[model samples]
Target: MYGSQPARTGRTTLLAVLLAPALALAGALVLLAAPAHAANAPRTSVNPVIFVHGQEGSAQQWQSQAKRFSSNGYRDDQLYVHEYDTSVATDDHAIAGLEALVDTVRARTGAAQVDILAHSRGTRVAHAYLAVPERAAEVAKYVNLDGRTAAAPPGGVPTLAIWSSLQPNGSIGGAVNVHEPQAGHTESATSAESFGHIYAFLRGRAPLTTRVLPELPTSVEIAGRALYFPQNTGLAGRLEVWRLDPATGARAGLLPQHVVRVGADGAFGPLAVNGRGHYELALVRSGERTNHFYFEPFERSDRFVRLLVSPPGGVADSIDACPGHTALTVVRAREWRADTEGDDRLRIGGSDVLNAAVSPRLRQILGLFVFDKGCDAVSHLDAALPPFDRIPFLTATDLHLPADAQARGTIPVTQTMRGTGGIEETIAVPNWPSDRHTVSLLFKDYADIPSGG
Candidate 1:
């Protein structure tokens, strides 16, 4: 039942043949007259959607789309990202993988069919699978994101073809072909507009809400990206939102009000916020807290807000001075060296220095000095040589430095009895900067300590 052409080459030629003036016009006319459906209509239960990524792509590619789906009421279990070694595997092998994935999803969800969405080279794998008689019946629908196929109505299932390039010739008989000429190939897979169309096609209705929410009624929406400094590239991690007490300006509770995973592109929520108040959004890696951003929701004039996670010492007054700084500002923990066996003491000209250190790369050292006496305060001291007496009893500095500065350097951490320990890091800096020219660094604790050094 599969098409006769060698998997890759024929689709392009077929597209050319199909794009005759008359057929193109017919397809356009059909697409224009398509009826619009109400998003709030009693929705039908949809089968799981299986996403296949392009060559050199990973399952992470689907993160934003998956969260978008989750925002629209689809559970995590209802979405499947089928990852494969596209470079090493043949089309047949990839199709076999897809087949197995589909079967597993079907059995787990107990749905009669699943919808398939494939991008770029992944279209070949989907087409190969759909061309098989047995597999054809298992898909309720298919979405072709910037991919070409010779046959109209690929797999004979209802199809929606979202194109980023020139309109394809000859319609896939009875399929909907959408032309998003402005979107890039990757954009077609991640854009909100594309998600709207996919949502409609898969659910047979429009989306009630295209953005993510905090599981509560919301009056405003917050959306933005996360990245690391110097390189200013997107970050993939978890975001925890906590509500604050307006009167005391303290966290209301230990549990987060909402949490969502940021995608590989660093794109995060259209997170729903209930009303104007104080909130703390924490960016964490794995489960370790890395950075905490505090803000008042009402202070924002617009529904959308932008947050830049600056590098340790590069949080200059303006973006120009910092250049490409996106590291998490601070790494904090309670009593980082409390019960350790050795005395880590820092002696600056005979007297014991308890708090802070000087990094040659930074102009200043910023940290929270936590004392054994049950009080904490933020201290901003010179990076070159912090005075012995000026240092606090216990301190945790949120160090910042220039984007191009050395990431691996020696910083001293000490207590009167504990002596001195050097905290060194071979920082894993991000490779690219976000549109905002910001990126973040994961905080590393002490590497080695030479007591009385």
Candidate 2:
């Protein structure tokens, strides 16, 4: 039921052709550096990698690293993401789902073993899966990212534990521990530095390029799933893909580029798109508000684009909806740190939202929800709102951005560099009334950090 989708089988052969020159150069270097034993040993292939996400996390968290791997030489078919419901009390269901995914990956790739990478709460689940000798035998390597610590590597597998600045002293007894002082909790998993460490640990050599190299616009294609938040259940709806004007984030045309009826699996697309183009993915359901997701750009073919939504009249429905204001949620894989020196900056409608109360380092906020708190039509930029601030990995702000659904206006959202620099990115999106439309924006965690060249 899981592996039958076209996305699971679609291979990015075009990427290989484009990267041949770089790959060939890197291949020669490996041969020259090989030891006598390695030259005599059987030729080995890169193992299929399966990524497991943490609590309230989806496969989207691994989006950037997956692209980096592909750029370095991994095929589209060789990467998999195990998405599970993180709200459950125990790891029983997560372990089962991961085991099934691992088996499926092995069956399709025809490999004896696969590599596992888990972050945050997912480390516990991965460790539990590795506890069984049979399961451990199926894994070639393991990466524990800013998650659990142990006296020894789980199941005695070769492990790499990556700790962020937040956990300065975190480590595992029998694993290679690398500390990234510039990153926060989630950033340690998505940062280019983290990718370098992971690639070296898994491949026994540094990556040819840690960056997510871009493909030509004509060669870029995308596909993904629309799932219920926290449950990982697919949503059946009408999905519309519309190209947007990068400057103002306005629709390019009246008609969508592609219209699909998303099935129970919530899978859609293998649709071609411009690598430099911005897009809006609108998920529309009958008698329900449309959830509109905006992305910066698809620099390459992406298969893990997740559109997470809650059921109508569900958890999200509890949000205060009003016609007088626009509601927006900005997401980045990196944790926002507003309480620290030289902290990150987030500006919406020309006002900075990051503050000591709104984005404390300990909160490790990945999603920042902005709206008029209590429909009071007042802007309180100094502090975070209740309920949302209490939630893990999330925070909310009360900001008044007037909107008219009939005639939309652009609302500029700017993110300045964490340290000293001018603006890093500015994504201007339309101000849609919160009563009928929901806006979500995706931002890269390492927007200013370049990978190893």
Tens digits of per-residue lDDT, candidate 2, 1-453, equal 123242344444223324357767775222111111212334348898989999999877899999888777567677888888887879999999898888888887679999999999999999999999999999999999999999999999999999988788999998999998778888888978899999999999987766777776666788889998888889999999999987888889999999999999898877888888899899998887789998878876788888988665445665688998999989898888888667888889889899889989888899988988788888888888877878898888889999887626998888875753554688888989999888898887766343234
Q: How high is each candidate's TM-score?
A: 0.43, 0.90
Give me the runs in candidate 2 sitting further than 4 Å from their true place. 1-9, 13-44, 312-315, 448-451
Error of 2 at 352 (Å): 1.2
Model 2 quality (TM-score):
0.90
In candidate 2, how many clashes are counted? Answer: 0
Best by TM-score: 2
Cand. 1 Cα-lDDT: 0.49
Task: State the displacement of the C-alpha of residue 9, model 2, in Å, after optimal TM-score superposition.
Answer: 4.4
Per-residue lDDT over 140-167 for candidate 1, one digit per residue giving the tens place of the 0 to 100 score: 9999887765557777888998886334
Against the unseen true structure, what C-alpha lDDT does each candidate score?
0.49, 0.82
Point out where model 1 deviates above 4 Å: 1-44, 166-171, 214-453
Give each prediction's root-mean-square deviation over alpha carbons.
21.2, 5.5
